[model samples]
Target: MQIMSNENAHSETDLRAEGVRVTRQRLAILHVLREASDHPRAEDILTRARLQDPSVSQATVYRTLAMLEKAGTVLRNEFDGAGARYELADRHHHDHLIDLDTGVVVEFQSPRIEQLQAEIAAELGYEIEWHRLELYGRKAT
Candidate 1:
């Protein structure tokens, strides 16, 4: 079994400070999110976490994911009209492009698009705090 070092223990401290109760399942879910390169659906997370903690129930995982999303510790985006995919939000929010053919998601950050959005919102005399941009397309054959 791996030991939790002082530094690793501090992450739990930080998470609790963010209003999340520290639990084995919550920590497991957080670990999965941190290690996931591709945002995963709730089912994906549940399946992966169950391998780590067999006692982890689907309902617990789903509830934990919802709490994490509400705390802004994770972000959720829907792709191809399917369920929402989740990713850990550290810094720098970006957009997603989902390949409808292969079911792959590509993340991209564009300053030009960000500037255009700000300008357009300003033109409409509205202030934008957050936004979600998801582009869906199929791969070329």
Candidate 2:
């Protein structure tokens, strides 16, 4: 997947466009998420937002994150089996491979898989709405 520059980072306008209320706490959370390459959990957001604004609280960050996810401004995935990790939602969609040994996540896209899903849905006489396929494995050394 392509990476975006931090300069094109998130702002209150983006949150508003997503129909999310523009709050100081929410904007802070979005800013941190936009800068993240790896998906982060609520705790990660709490820590970074706190560093940016001392008044920001963990509860506020969690609430804002949930709101952002609902608004499609961010995506959530459970990678480490602890809690879901959060990333800024963009135009592209990709699957994740998790490293069981170290709990690392790698994102990849496969056109074949996408086509297969469509074919499978057609064979079953059902329409696919959305799907998430996560493959968990250890790094082959």
Candidate 3:
């Protein structure tokens, strides 16, 4: 995933395009997501939003996240035994490699892997509509 720059961020416009009303609380949540390179959970987002505006509540943060997810403006990733993590959904398609020890996520793309997936689906007489690939591993020592 690419880090969104302040000048190029499209959270506000994306929300409006999705017919969602733009509010301060929602904007604060979006700001937190846009500025974060690491995918953060809803609670983490709530903490950052509260720091930005003390009046912001956990309910509001969760509600906004759901709205964003519905609108395809954010992606919610749920790793094994770990709570969901949120990131902006505007980047190109990529797969994740999760660090099992530390819960860190690394995004990568491989043409060979993509081709093999297509070939396997074809061999099974199925056309792929969508797929998610997540590999769990530890960092090289």
Candidate 4:
């Protein structure tokens, strides 16, 4: 299982392409997300964004996150019924393993699992539009 990378780092131009109003706060938020491997919550984003631009606000973080998710530039995951954690949507398809005890998220890709899902979908006479696989577990005792 490989952790995600900055392969899809976004910029102000991305927001413009998404037809969003580009601002310093938004750019700082984007920078924070681009540098994050661990999917972060809005509060974490706001805190990091403020480090990049002191003018960033909590409302702006939430609003920008909503805009990015709506624009399909970011993805919101509610693992273990937890508050939304976010990651860039452009990364290669992968599944997650959440540490139930520590609330850590690990990203991994598996072709065998992908093939099995496709096979199952075919058996069900349905096509998969999209899917999310999350496994919650703890370290071996």
Please list all clashing residue pairs in model 3, or write none if there are none: none
> Across residues 1-141, which tens digit of lDDT does each residue of candidate 3 receive?
342232227667767888999999998898898888678899999999988888889899989999889988889999775899988887767788888988878777777887899999999999889788889998888
Residue-level lDDT of model 4, residues 47-131, one tens digit each, is 8999889998899999989988999989999998879999888789989999998988988888888889999999999889999
Instruction: Compute each candidate's TM-score over C-alphas.
Output: 0.86, 0.86, 0.88, 0.93
> Model 2: runs farther than 4 Å from truth?
1-11
lDDT of each: 0.78, 0.78, 0.83, 0.87
The most accurate candidate by lDDT is 4
Among these predictions, the greatest TM-score belongs to 4
The residue-by-residue lDDT of candidate 2 on 1-141, one tens digit each, is: 332232335667766776777877776787888777667788988898888887889879878877777887778887757798988776467788887877777777788888899899999999899889888998777
Error of 4 at 72 (Å): 0.5
Residue pairs with backbone overlap in model 2: none
As for model 2, its CA RMSD to the true structure in angstroms is 2.7
Q: What is the lDDT of residue 97 in candidate 4?
A: 92
Model 2 error, position 108 (Å): 0.5
Error of 3 at 97 (Å): 1.0
- Can you give the lDDT of residue 46 in candidate 4? 90
Please count the clashing residue pairs in each candidate, in the order shown: 0, 0, 0, 0
